[model samples]
Target: MENELTLKRFVDIRRNLGYTQVEFAKVLDIRNTTADIERGRTKLSGKVVAELLKQFKINPLWLFGESEMQYLEPSKTSVIPKVVTVDSSDNENMVLVNAKAAAGYPQNIQDTSWYKQLPAFDLPLPEFRNATYRGFQVEGDSMLPNLKPGEWVLAKAVEDIAHVSPNKIYVIVLEDAVLVKKIEKAPNSNNVTLISLNDSYPPYRIEPQQIQEIWQVNSKITFGVDATTEKGLLRQLQESMEELKNQFNHGKS
Candidate 1:
């Protein structure tokens, strides 16, 4: 009963804390071992548990099953459940579209019937709750300092042309090719200009009618890893990424 209570408490805590196992592990200064905790195959040290109790002010009775207590006084807010359901077919060939693809334009090729035949594996998709992946591959060196050629980027599919923002990066399918570029809405017109991050390419404006599809890029969690022992490394990395983005924006301006 005590063990069951512990497991239940852990689940409750994790849910309330709004952390995926990976995020929770990072917060605990545990590197890449969240799966163990979730599986109940590993136990946290007494010191770590105590720290959690102290920091979170969790109900000890609920955690240890000393009493029928369920609620903690200083409660953490519940997180919205985010689940990613992948097709069952493409499990084995499930590749991370990390960089842009240098070959054929994935976005322009609308015949995804081939993908349906591949075995599928599901990953706990990242926290971009409102977005869906519209595949795009990298090309050229415009986004070079940050994105490399042959790396794949997952873009959020947008149905409306009005949804595309000015001066924001987007994955666009134009006729036979898909390209990633910064888009700027033309003043008082339906046309939009495509701008490349690299200065070697000249900016080109195109009418909305010329586009086949447009996708918004949300570049969070392009990589996955387990827990780590490094203190605040995740936080630091997030900050660094933000800083890099700002620097890129400044340079482009």
Candidate 2:
């Protein structure tokens, strides 16, 4: 029989704890074989599962798919806040919207079609629970290490413009485009500066009236490699390519 504690579930559980495969493997004191285990190509050695439960307070039943709850109880040393799906009574809803949601968000914010069609899930972060939240498929690397293309950012709706904080990430609505960028309060002006985390992309200033809606990005679900790591690799590759190009040009000269 296929193991209920499949590799996919293991990766999902690690992501829930905000740890990467390498980091989680380090915590478990496993030697350099976490990728295989996370890929389900291998299983834990004897006593490894017991050590994992002891170190991370993981619920064995939950890990093995025998239970729905994630953790047996709070770990005394755990500084991370525990999260669970919203109970059945509250109807906590979060719909994952497509990249086009940015362009159509203002129009479809009240519509049920997109909300119903997209994949939705619930989270229990108290600071964000009060607001209407949705997942937006982001694109472009302008935000760099903060937000990346093909990732879904969980954004909470901001009905009032005054509530936006300076230098915080926001999903801003425009007539033709929807963008995720940092907001910088301008000096004695009605406009706010939209900034990108990647320095290559320059900052832009726009009038608040141009903004149709605003949403605060609270969390993100990423696929493939982490953005920070990917960016570093890209930067290295770019530098190498430039050097190689320069050498070729010098040789030709």
Candidate 3:
């Protein structure tokens, strides 16, 4: 009986997504197993379940007959970026958005040729290996002593708005402007409050509809800073402190 319910629910998922059996299999990249599982000739495997969770944001408990909820929150759906550029090898390249291009980014973001014209490169870092990344030039003094003007911030696209972590900085793309700000979840509301590291700029709230894209700031690049300068030394110290905090959290977990 449990198996029957799970199989029925799985078919319902395909219908809900408006995908045929073949189409759903293509999306999950498991064409071989999809038909078998749907017909009850085989049981669903853990790997398939993981893929469904990662791709469709489907509620795992519900699929297993453990809960009544059929799906996770709609806000958890991953936002697929448009007009992404790729290298000759077909690997994704991180596109650079300098201050000049940023001004027109919001309006021309969907233009494929615009992305092609932007400078792009690939990094050998492990953390950046499996994700789409983009670089944005920092402008103004809004971020303050931590992120200086003219520095470049490399960020990965958030899988979903619901996955946005609080107290971290993000490069938020809006219809009219692009802003790099710290995020704070507004209590009991779908809107978010954008905060700044520098107290001079007051925090502001924005509705979800205003957000075009959200990229979590991962690391930064700056030139002409070495061990001899105060700014360089401060930057090193900050990196070290953050590394230590991460290590401590990992150990605790």
* lDDT tens readout by residue for model 1, 1-253: 1376687778778889898888878777777856676567777556657656777866565577765645544533221111223545633222222233323334424445534432222323333334455444476688766667644465666755656786567877665566788888867875678988888889998866567667777663322332121233234335545665677678779
What residue runs in model 2 are displaced by over 4 Å at the alpha carbon?
1-90, 100-103, 124-128, 224-253
lDDT of 2 by residue, 1-253 (tens): 2274655567776788888777887877887647877656677554666766777666666667777756645422221111112336775666555675456655654565545544455543344466676567788999888777877677777755656787578877665577889887766766778988899999988877667667788766654443244354334334543565576678779
After best superposition, candidate 1 residue 166: deviation in angstroms?
2.3
lDDT of 3 at 116: 71
**Runs in model 1 lying further than 4 Å from the true structure:** 1-86, 89-108, 117-121, 126-130, 220-253
Clashes of each: 25, 0, 0
Best-performing candidate as measured by lDDT: 3
* Backbone clashes in model 1: 25
- Which of 1 and 3 is the better model by TM-score? 3
Q: For candidate 3, give the lDDT.
A: 0.78
**TM-scores of all models?**
0.44, 0.48, 0.65
lDDT of 2: 0.64
lDDT winner between candidates 1 and 2: 2
lDDT (Cα, tens digit) per residue for candidate 3, span 24-68:
888877764467888888678787788888888778888998877
Clashing pairs in 2: none
